[model samples]
Target: MPVARVVVDVMLKPEILDPQGQAVSRALVRLGFDGISDVRQGKRFELEVEGPVDDDALGRIHKIAESFLANTVIEDFTVRVENGDAS
Candidate 1:
């Protein structure tokens, strides 16, 4: 079996509100940073897996994202492999 590294980015949809990011931006403004308009927050996931490189593996990864990794109601996720994965 081959080893694979996966990097996933999960982010809230544009229509969704990001209170934590908003608060951070506001704090930045209060600290004298200017011209900052909006802020959004997201999550990053990194993992290693063993599998063949194929569409079925990709689909299984997506299912993992949908089942446990991402909040489907307000967020979307993207999956990518690092260039040197060798799997």
Candidate 2:
């Protein structure tokens, strides 16, 4: 059976503070990396499923991302479906 590959990116809301990102940005500056103004940390998730994925499956994945992967109150997420490769 063919498989579907899904990728989800979760990031903090604009108003939410990201201390880790800030620290990384500062470190970069200290290391002489210029032109770096701001940074925000995020998470990426890759999922593989057996069989072809449809709209219904996408909806279910979105629900899972919103409920289990991201904190909707302080974070937002985006889901992407890859075309051919499932690995």
TM-scores of the candidates in the order shown: 0.81, 0.91
Computed on alpha carbons, the lDDT of every model, listed in order, comes to 0.85, 0.92
Best by TM-score: 2
lDDT of 1 by residue, 1-87 (tens): 888777778999999999989998999899999988988889988767798646787788888998889999999999887678354
TM-score of 2: 0.91
lDDT of 2: 0.92
Clashing pairs in 2: none
Residue pairs in steric clash, candidate 1? none
Model 2 superposed RMSD (Cα):
1.9
Candidate 2 per-residue C-alpha lDDT over 1-87 given as tens digits, one digit per residue, 9 for 90 to 100: 877789999999999999999999999999999998999999999899677688889899999999999999999999999777435
lDDT of 1: 0.85
